[model samples]
Target: MVSKVNDLDYFVAASEQEALILELNLIKRHHPRYNVRLKDDKTFPYLKIDLNEDWPRVHITRRLEEDGGRYFGPFASAKSVRQTLKLIKGIFPFRSCSKPITGTDTRACLDYDIGHCLAPCIGAVSQKEYAEVIKRVILFLEGKQERVVQQLKSKMNRAAEALDFERAVRLRDQIQAVEQVVEGQRIATTVKGEQDVIAFAGDKDQACVQVFFIRSGKLIGRESFLLQGTR
Candidate 1:
């Protein structure tokens, strides 16, 4: 391969990290023959919260932009990301719709009818209240579910005390759901702290790497990367 080369090209960067980034970009663009290649390499999905909006909405995105909103997870798979979104939507009544929030919609959308949304579009929920919900969602995504559960428990107690039985019931259900998810997480490590467990497998032509993200001993998330050019 080296003997066949007619000429050489080079690039320089200000820092090692910058150089690595440039190298990755070049490899992605040109798919160099000798470079180890990722099979089906694509940008992983992220949960984006655009706070710039009048009512920030949490949804999935593949691109990371400088839109001044919080982004979470270059998660393993689209299916897992969507499942996480569904779980969050079930617990927090944030708006999933893209419709403008004028608070004047004549009718709430199906998301509202199905109890998946707070219907901010129709003024069913105040901006301040919706913001609080978004806060919990962010906390949940950050693997700070304990803090979120504490907040929910506090609110649930208050609602029950105030005789808002419906709201109290909703909060109770959310707390239970969070607890169930937490309990379902297996203890992937005995070290008693957060760490990633990585494993790799390969053949002559292909390889796969798996990562298990453990937080406080619990298996929180996992991702797999497939690679080619193993020979």
Candidate 2:
């Protein structure tokens, strides 16, 4: 039998058979949502990339299925996720179109004209070469920071050797951006790698607390919250 006492629910069974009977009846009658089954409807947003396909594309989604693609993120903020994706699309330009890049008579989007996308939508980059660039992005997102930094350094060196100062400068800037992300991650986490801290205080009528963000051994920011009673 299950009963409520002091706002808490308690269940008691005298014997195994009785427990089984109680459980079966609970499942059949009350059918309490939590006791019936687990829900799979909610999920956090993630960035999905089809790296193995002929013409890869990056998409923002909330599903997790094994479709021979790569997935990243359970980012706390949609805006931050979008901004990071924009930054990546700017430098990497792996394809963002829905259609295959076959002989589609494609034209460059605004991203290309604004120097954000590499215009893979227009067949500017072949599948094999674009796959290589996507691989670099995957490595960078997978926390293989040194690998990406080394690869960018090599690219910058090659561009400099080939007397392409403009390309070399761009590569240098990309490397710096990657470094900045790593540094930011380090600063966002505590020494134990915990990202944020939360505290709360409350009474019958109201509640409030201040949250402090300690980044890289420094208190960087804080926020306070207040809650109201309904009745």
Candidate 3:
């Protein structure tokens, strides 16, 4: 039994399950207007990639399905997912435009000028080639990083063979970027396989859990969450 701090109201339960049942029954009986979330149907957002389309686009979404396109996560934070999407757009140059680029004569967006995109919006790259980039990005999101690294290595070697030193150097830098991500993963997950490291702190009233996701011996990302009340 637990007594209210400021009122004579009291609650009692035989066990954890009974406690939950009692709490739910109380909420339903009273139908308290102060509990906003109790009547809401909202859920956290996710990252969705529509690979089935001819021109795939990655977007932050709230929908969930077992579709063909890739889905990254039910991220703990919308800000983190947005930031990650930005980084992915920068590296992979996947199109972010909502409308189809077909038959449009407009110039490339600012992202193209800054090299953040491959300019698929204006025929700078073919749909087929852009699809290839999307494939690589999907592989990366799935933690099969070696695919991208190996492709970059081949390109670097070919550039070097043709005496295109500048291009070869550029490819080398991209390869290094991929390697850095891989190394970070290795340090985060010392184990040989995919595993998640989670740590929790706090007492009965409030608590937070930090989760680190390691895939293919790499530390890809981390998230944290706070829980209110005892469970």
Q: Rate the local accuracy (lDDT) of all candidates.
A: 0.84, 0.68, 0.74
Highest lDDT model number: 1
Global lDDT of model 2: 0.68
Over 1-231, each residue of candidate 1 has an lDDT whose tens digit, in order, gives: 989788898987996435654665677788877876532366668899999998999999976677899988666679988999998988888988887789998999888887778898888998888899999999988888889899999999999999999989988988998888788786745597768789999998999999987878778877789999986
For candidate 3, list the clashing residue pairs, or say none: 185-218, 185-219
Question: How do all the candidates rank in terms of TM-score, highest first?
Answer: 1, 3, 2
Between candidates 1 and 3, the TM-score winner: 1
lDDT of 3 by residue, 19-121 (tens): 6445555665677666554333444557789977888889998656667877876665689889878766756767788877773558988877766566766
Q: What TM-score would every model get versus the actual structure?
A: 0.77, 0.63, 0.70
Encode model 2's per-residue lDDT on 23-96: one tens digit a residue: 55556566556564413443456788886677777778866677998887654446656876886776665667
Cα lDDT over the full model 3: 0.74
Predict model 1's lDDT versus the native. 0.84
Better by lDDT, candidate 3 or 1? 1
Off by over 4 Å in 3: 1-39, 65-67, 103-106, 160-170, 188-190, 200-208, 225-231
Error of 1 at 112 (Å): 1.5
- What would the TM-score be for candidate 2 when compared with the true structure? 0.63
Residue runs of model 1 more than 4 Å from their true location after superposition: 1-42, 186-189, 198-210, 224-231
